[model samples]
Target: MSATEEAMNRRIVLARRPEGEPGVEDFRLEAGPVPEPGPGEMLCRTLYLSVDPYMRGRMNAGPSYAPSVGLGDVMVGGSVSRVLASRLEGYVPGDLVAGFNGWQDYALSDGTRIRRVDPELAPPPAFLGALGMTGLTAYVGLFDIADPQPGETVAVAAAAGAVGSMVVQLATLRGCRVVAIAGSPAKCGYLREVLGADVALDYHDPNFPETLEAACPQGIDVYFENVGGAVFEAVLPLLNIGARVPVCGQIAHYNDSGNPLPGPDSLPRLMMWVLGRRLRMQGFIVGDHLDRLPDFVREMGGWLREGRIRHYEDIVDGLENAPAAFIDMLRGGNLGKRLIRVVPEDAAGA
Candidate 1:
């Protein structure tokens, strides 16, 4: 009936709005009795929880594409969970699912749009990543927005992270010369050696702009803007005429108070490039492309089965560690899809 009428639940709630960079203290661990499910509803036990850069934006008390995480509310996230109890017709106990279960140990759902997780196809984390929103975002941002052509050069910032890694794989398979940009040399190596990027460069290099120039001698045809800021400045000059830019994320500016980044060039310079190069740069929310979910699942599923698409996860154990994992991921401390294993694999009692 009410929140206090159900079983005990443990969760991470938003403690405070971050001023600049979000600190670990911004989240608070809370315990309360779980809300009971009514008719046409179900209770889900969280298995794997996602920690993303976008969550940092939600911690602020301001208007965004989505509503902000209210102070004392559960920190928002996507999770792979199992149905612990159900009053709905289709859902039953032990049915694995993927939904917006947040950082809590359990969730109460009215059985609206949540999808079942098929472990036979892929692992649970893959749904939170590659075969899920992360992969779809990469698909839309690269193929739909960027529209990269074969034999052309396509560059990606944050190239070793979840969406960025997928971008490199898709663009590379599409016959584009993929150049990966990342924060460290190890990530650069992973991009080049493992993901098959044609060229991988470290953005932390003092002469990064020059290095990017040398890598893309023929000029970049499509630029997947993930870590905007200094990366944006480096990409602007190397764009070819009629180049496409998918403004997916700006992780470099996520911690900024008001100003996203204080790079050498101004906004006026960016506008000039857009006008002069006939460039088309647009922002997107993957949720906007939900109509294509079936298509994504089929194709991405095939790719996964055939080993055409490979995914990675930087997994941390325990639900209590979720906040720290999220904080670390924001700082590029993780190498892949950062996730918290809220429950064990045998949590369903095998």
Candidate 2:
């Protein structure tokens, strides 16, 4: 590579901790030299960057399931990258991989947590969405944790998103009647028409709780909790006896300032429902279930080949726009998996 190319590594770092909703000011984009790989290491050029809701938590100062992103550090994220140079044994130049390359244009990896991606099986970006961690999250959360039976009513929040979209389709394949919830009409249409959800409801409607209850006439047998707060409150009273709730994400509450929400305490009501219905609520981190990845890849791969599943992505161009896209995703502005196209589509294959 030319010296100019090696000097063109651009990165987006956390400029400051967000107060409530994060703004573009919280991130600063800067250019730096792309470092050469040492023995047993590889240099990779990032192609696609994934912007997820969990990243919001990582930006905070408090402790979470993962360590917080330190100020002035490269923001944490996953990426689809191409091996540019390698001294690693198995990896070679031109090989594609999925790994934690963060929000940088180039990164070095010693093969830790890195997986080779076969671009022939699926498009490269799919590795960052349905065929990668996102798909595994849905598979593990729904089948392993929630365990919805055939003919059960399964309600999924954020039903048009990456993980939720997979859960909607997989639940349908399992013979469960799915009631999908989204923030907008367009996303609701995609959930019902494209994803094959039995019923789709717009959560912005004033009567969303009542509408959701009406849709699940038999009561919700399984609730995939993606958005917490009001969405959780709505699903609480509608849970059937022996219901299972897989707490996947709580996007709505991620931006809160840690103060209690102003309202009557609803813990007593939630407790009563849990006690009377014997509901099983479990929160899971996808990293904890990596042992099942091979099985998921095998089955989900076949489903993709047979056209039994379809994945959607909302991609933004350039690394500079990632912060805006991420902030938009956090506010429920995205229709599917939100990704940043670090490399232009025409040149991505190169």
In terms of lDDT, the best-performing candidate is 2
What TM-score, over all chains together, does every model reach? 0.95, 0.96
| Local distance difference test, candidate 2 | 0.90
Tens digit per residue, CA lDDT, model 2, 1-350: 56426467899999999999999999999998888899999998899999999999999987679999999999999999988888999998889999999999999999999998987778988888888888899999999999888999999999988889999999999999999989899999999989999999999999999999899889999999988888888988899999999997889888888753434567676777889999999989999998998998889888988899898889999999999999999998887789999986456433
Q: What are the Cα lDDT values of the candidates?
A: 0.88, 0.90
Give the TM-score (vs. native) of candidate 2. 0.96
Report RMSD (Å) for each prediction in the order shown: 2.5, 1.7
lDDT of 1 by residue, 298-318 (tens): 989999899988899889999
Residue pairs with clashing backbones, model 1: none
